[model samples]
Target: DTAVSQTPKYLVTQMGNDKSIKCEQNLGHDTMYWYKQDSKKFLKIMFSYNNKELIINETVPNRFSPKSPDKAHLNLHINSLELGDSAVYFCASSQVAGGLADTQYFGPGTRLTVL
Candidate 1:
């Protein structure tokens, strides 16, 4: 069984549109994260939620938002999508270890294309 899953594995949209992607994890972990992988293959953390509380990355734009209704699910919403926003989005989950989060278990990414 998959530990983490994302909906709409592939998304194609036009610029200035809005989109949302959903994620769910069955690992029973308390911490979850959203990451973006650019065309150059650089992966960066966009947001993280621990026990449903938000921790956003400073570099992430305001257009990107993460919402966790509960510990097992985290969803991403992007407003006014831009061409530069086209990338592969990944969801990951992990548990705390020694006062810090442990290794993350990632979901199959959702590839978003903006035209």
Candidate 2:
């Protein structure tokens, strides 16, 4: 009965390799987001999708792609992974209720390591 879940919580690979992280939410939310937490513990939003439609997309590199198969699922794909791409990727979901945005529920996070 987890609210959010991610597969392969830990990914270890070499540079230039391609990888993808899958996320799913069971909260029946309408919006999902992809965030990255750098080594310095700075959290930044990369992409957001509302009802499977692209919304907020930060100034991230083209190698990073966010896809929402549906309102409850969001996935991230990284191409030619670089050392800079090594970070903790987080998946979050939120919904508006009574004209107010609810607290975002985050997954445990997927730690991607590039050698």
lDDT of each: 0.90, 0.86
State in Å the error of residue 31, model 2.
Answer: 0.2
lDDT of 2 by residue, 1-115 (tens): 9999998799999999999999999999887888899999999888877865675555799898887777778889999999988999999888852112678889999999999
- Model 1 per-residue lDDT tens digits across residues 1-115: 9999999899999999999999999999888889999999999988888875688889999999988888799999999999999999999988872123478999999999999
Q: Which residue pairs in candidate 1 have backbone atoms (N, alpha carbon, C) closer than 3 angstroms, thus clashing? A: none
> What TM-score does model 1 achieve against the real structure?
0.94
Worst 10 residues of 1 by lDDT: 94-103
Q: How close is each model in CA RMSD to the real structure? A: 1.8, 2.3
Looking at candidate 2, what is the lDDT of residue 52? Answer: 52
CA lDDT of 10 in candidate 1? 99
